[model samples]
Structure formats: structure tokens, C-alpha cells
Target: IPDDLLEAARIDGASEFRIFGSIVLPALKPIIVTLAVFTLLGTWNDFMWPLIVLTDKDLYTLPVALAALSREHVQDDELMMAGSVVTIVPVLLVFLSLQRYYLQGLLAGSVKG
Candidate 1:
């Protein structure tokens, strides 16, 4: 993201598109990854909005469906635990898969590049 680098690219006859693709996007990688992780976590755990917007039972998200399940099976601890596991597993897997990139993004602005 140095102005000098962009100037050099322009002086070297690189098109604006090429400079952006090669320089701007690479510089934005950490921020983009961090944002994606945060977005995924937010949407994955979101409950109230989906509950209000999605009226159909079949269109329910995991958290809303799980809430409905809990309402129906209040006395069923084992089933509730299983449902919780099912709901959490995919989120866990996604975080694990992107953990390194996510952490890098979080730390990107912490130290001077």
C-alpha cells in the first residue's frame, strides 16, 4: 500500500487494473479474511432476525430450529445436547479451517508493516 510502489508500477507502464490486482488486493488480504471470518461468525450465530423473517418451519436456520426443538423437548436433555452439537460442528469446522488467516487479519494492524 505504499504510494511509492504504486507510482513505480505506473512509471513501469502497468495498467491501473494490473496495479490494483497485484498490489491493492494483496495488501487487502488480511483485512478481507478478517472481515469474512467475522461475517461468518455473526451470521452463523444470528437468531432473532432469522426467527422473525423466516416463517416457514422448513426455512429455519439451525439456531431458530434448535430453539423450536428445545420448546418441544424441554425435558429431553440428551436430544438437546445432540442438537447443540449438530449446530456447532459446522461453525467449529469453518473456524478451524480459516483460523490462521483469521488470526493473521486480526494481528495485521497490531504491528507496523
Candidate 2:
């Protein structure tokens, strides 16, 4: 997003790919990581679309599997809780691992030019 850095790279005869790899990509790292984490979380937790699209039992995602489990075990509170925990833990770990970048992206977006 910094025009001066890009202009300088152009003046130095860097290729577009080089400029992107050396300058733009590094500058965008935090935001990119943050976006990746969000995208992963969204995809991981998505249930309805996958349920609607996937008819095969083996292709069911974790959420869909959990939903099926819940339907079959409606009276079992402990099993449902365990399933819920299993579904949530991975997303929690991923968010915690990339929390720094997520916070950085939030701060970066909040700053006014």
C-alpha cells in the first residue's frame, strides 16, 4: 500500500513479482495471516452448505458429523458436550496461535492515513 516503496522498486528495475515478493507481500503479512485464519475458521465451522451439497456419508465435515451424532444421541448430554468441545478446540487453537497477527491487522486497519 506504500506507493513510494513500489515506485522505488520499479526504479531499481525489480520485476513485478520481485516487487510483490519482497515488498508488498511482507507489508501485507499480518493482514494476510489474519484473513487466512478467518477463512479457515469460516470453512472449518461451516455446516449447512456442506450438509446440503454432500450426500455421501464419508464426505461429511466435522460439523455435519457432529450434527448427525447429535440427532442420533439426543438424550446424551455428555456425548454432545464432547462433540461440541472437539468441534471448537481446533478453531480456538488456530485463533490463539495467530492472535498476534489478528490483533495487528485490527490495529493496522484502525489507523487513519
Candidate 3:
């Protein structure tokens, strides 16, 4: 991690943080966003862990809260849709923000014929 980041840092010669701010982070943004989205979604929908960890309904994170909410409001399709939207928005924003990196990395990886 540091090796790749530091190589990028060295080439750019921005300060330590500046190196990351300009070069390393830009290059890694796609992967970071991808992971963040995955982590967010995974945590969001994680019912069992939340159930085990959080005894109080008020303290539930979104997924567990939504699951409990769904049970109480089983017939509410709009509410379900809203829950889905809430869970998905962060992932969409992150992916949209980092799309260019995905394209660049994809191209870089496929450069042999």
C-alpha cells in the first residue's frame, strides 16, 4: 500500500499529504469508492450483526431499523422503496464520483493484445 502510494508520492513530489491529495488518492479513488460503497451497503443491510450488537431498536442502524420498520409496516410499498433509496444513494454518489478511475484502471489493465 505504502509502496504504491509512496511511488506515486515520489513522482509527484507534492508534500506527504499533498502527494496523496494530488496523485495517489486520485489514482486510488475508484478502488476506495468501490470499497466504501461495498462496506456501506454491507453494513446497511447487515441484519444479524446489528441484531446481536444492538438491543435497543432506537439505536439500530439503517438496515436493522428498516427491517424492523418493514415488519411493522409490511404493507407499505412506498416506505420500502424509500428505504431502498436511502440505502442506495451513498453507493450511487460514490460510484458516480469515481467513475473515471474505473475507466482508466480498466483500460490500463486491458492494454495487451
Candidate 4:
């Protein structure tokens, strides 16, 4: 955030909350979205930790479930492909939903004032 902008807002009699809401939050949107996407992708595709931690077959995550499905149906290529597609679709939807903000974050300027 720019100190000069906040100082200017103060000079204009804008309250702290107003300054934060009007300025800080908008400036942070791209960063927040980027972080959210990264975290989501990390957790969504995670396999090993969930597989090791969960004992119940019913509590498995998509990747672990997919792995088990593969093991059970080793001869079924079509079923394995279908399982993979189902696992990927939700993440793709999330990325497309936030694509604008994520791209903005990637292309944001780094120039210092």
C-alpha cells in the first residue's frame, strides 16, 4: 500500500474504516484470489497425506478414492479415465471462475512509488 494515498485520504477526512474499505481491500483483491487459488490447488490435489491419515474407506479424498478405484479395476481403462475426469472438473471450474483475478495477479505491476 502507498503511504501517500492513505495520508491523502486522511487529509480529505476519510475515516480509517473508509480508507481500508475503499483502498486497501480493492488493492488486495488480486493477491487474495491468487493465494486462495494456490491453497485450493495444493489441498485439492493432495494425495499422500490424506491417504496416510484417514483410516476409513468412506472418508477418502478424490485422489485417494481414484487410486483405490484404479487398484480395484486395473483392467478398466475407460473407468479410470472417467474417474480422472471427474476428479479434474471441479478444480477446472474453480480456476475458470477466478481466472480474471488470478491473471491480474500474475500480470500486476512491480514498480515502486
Measured by TM-score, the strongest candidate is 4
Residue 19 accuracy (lDDT) in model 1:
89
Candidate 3, residues 1-113, lDDT tens digits: the string is: 34654665577666777866765566676687678777876866778887898988889977777888899999999999999899778767866876777787554322222
Worst 10 residues of 2 by lDDT: 104-113
How does each model score on TM-score? 0.69, 0.67, 0.60, 0.76
Tell me how many residue pairs clash in candidate 2.
Answer: 0
**Model 2 residue 93 lDDT score:** 94
Name the lDDT of candidate 3. 0.73
All models, RMSD in angstroms? 3.7, 4.0, 5.6, 3.1
Q: Give the winner by lDDT: 2 or 3.
A: 2
Query: Which runs of model 3 end up more than 4 angstroms from their true locations?
Result: 1-33, 109-113
Please give the TM-score that candidate 4 achieves against the real structure.
0.76
The TM-score that candidate 3 achieves is 0.60
- lDDT tens readout by residue for model 4, 16-109: 9999898777778888887998999999989999999999999999999999998999999999999899999999999899888856655443
Off by over 4 Å in 1: 4-13, 103-113
lDDT by residue (tens digit), candidate 2, 1-113? 65776787899999999998987776688978878987998999898999999999899999999889889888999988998899899999987887787565445423234
For each candidate, the alpha-carbon lDDT, in order, equals 0.83, 0.83, 0.73, 0.86
At residue 57, candidate 2 shows an lDDT of 81
